[model samples]
Target: MAGVRQFDEDSAFEQALEVFRAKGYRATSMLDLAKSTGVQRGSLYNAYGDKEEIFSRVFERYADRFVADARVALNKAGLREALVEFFVFAIRSITQGSPARGCLSTKIAVEIASESPRQQELVKKMLDELEDVLVGVLQSPEARAQLVIPPRQAARIIVTMTRGIAVMERVYSDPKRLRQTASALIDTMVRPG
Candidate 1:
């Protein structure tokens, strides 16, 4: 294989995603990407296009995993259990690895989405997927009998609370307290009125 360079894209994406997630989109430079990925700056540009495009790729990778996790959470037998699993998934996602990186879609949704239409659409897509799953869960037989609010409103509240937990995890490192708070909120939100 003449002139063929071999490299692990998943490994590169992991390295690059960590740097972007930790430092954010604007703070990370091409040099940083090259250094973190162990690839040369020129090669990085050649391989992944510009920094903006590269970031889009990283965001896509993150959304893929998040969507998959949300699907698993939504698969729980009980609505309460499913939503609880979702909250747990959100907390673990934000708290993954050292220094509490938080959710990229959540972080970038606030930080970058407002300014970039492309990013806004991306964030909305991820949220929309989760919300659709949540709506389904809320419409389940058990959840319907104990409905606190309409399915759309309930899903919105759940998604907002989920994002808030992600943001708060950076400030509050104690998982027990966070989970307790989430449980309380879930009970309140889902309680039949």
Candidate 2:
């Protein structure tokens, strides 16, 4: 008899991530994961322990990808260029994706922040990480000495603006408008007064 081929854990996690991305964490069910991953419900439980565990795994994978992308953006030639690339990458990922799912962390933050402390903390961590990356790219010390705005504050502004843009893209299908808005944001940030 031929041996059965088993799906790898990473592949299963990727499938689950796609489902969770399309449907928010609370909205996703075990059946959904099973259907999406081509795994039996019992097998899913055996592999990942539980729904929250699976979500945690998916979240970790997603965060790793996001941070990797941010690192790449920050490593580009100049600060302004890096920031522009970061924003453009975000716009493209959110607007052009198959499921058209916005940022998973952002979606969860807006919906569940008030409901669970754990979720709120996760959201806060995600935002803080993004801000930290922005601060590094903006060259915080120089920006502060110039009195343009404090590094921390500017980082918060960038994260907030990006989050808002992502939310808008999730609801609106106006690609040209989003592209224009993203460009305007990059220009404003890059311009020296």
Q: Count the backbone clashes (under 3 Å) in each candidate.
A: 0, 0
- Point to the candidate with the largest lDDT: 1
Write candidate 2's Cα lDDT for 1-193 as tens digits.
2334366778889999888888988899999999999989888887678888888778777877886787676677655666668777777667657657778888878777678786677677777887888787676554444435666776788788878887888788666677678667666655563
lDDT of each: 0.82, 0.76
Clashing pairs for model 2 are none
lDDT of 1 by residue, 29-55 (tens): 999998998888887787777888888
Best-fitting candidate, scored by TM-score: 1
TM-score of 2: 0.85
Off by over 4 Å in 2: 1-6, 140-147
Query: Looking at candidate 1, what is the lDDT of residue 101?
Result: 81
- Global local distance difference test of model 1: 0.82
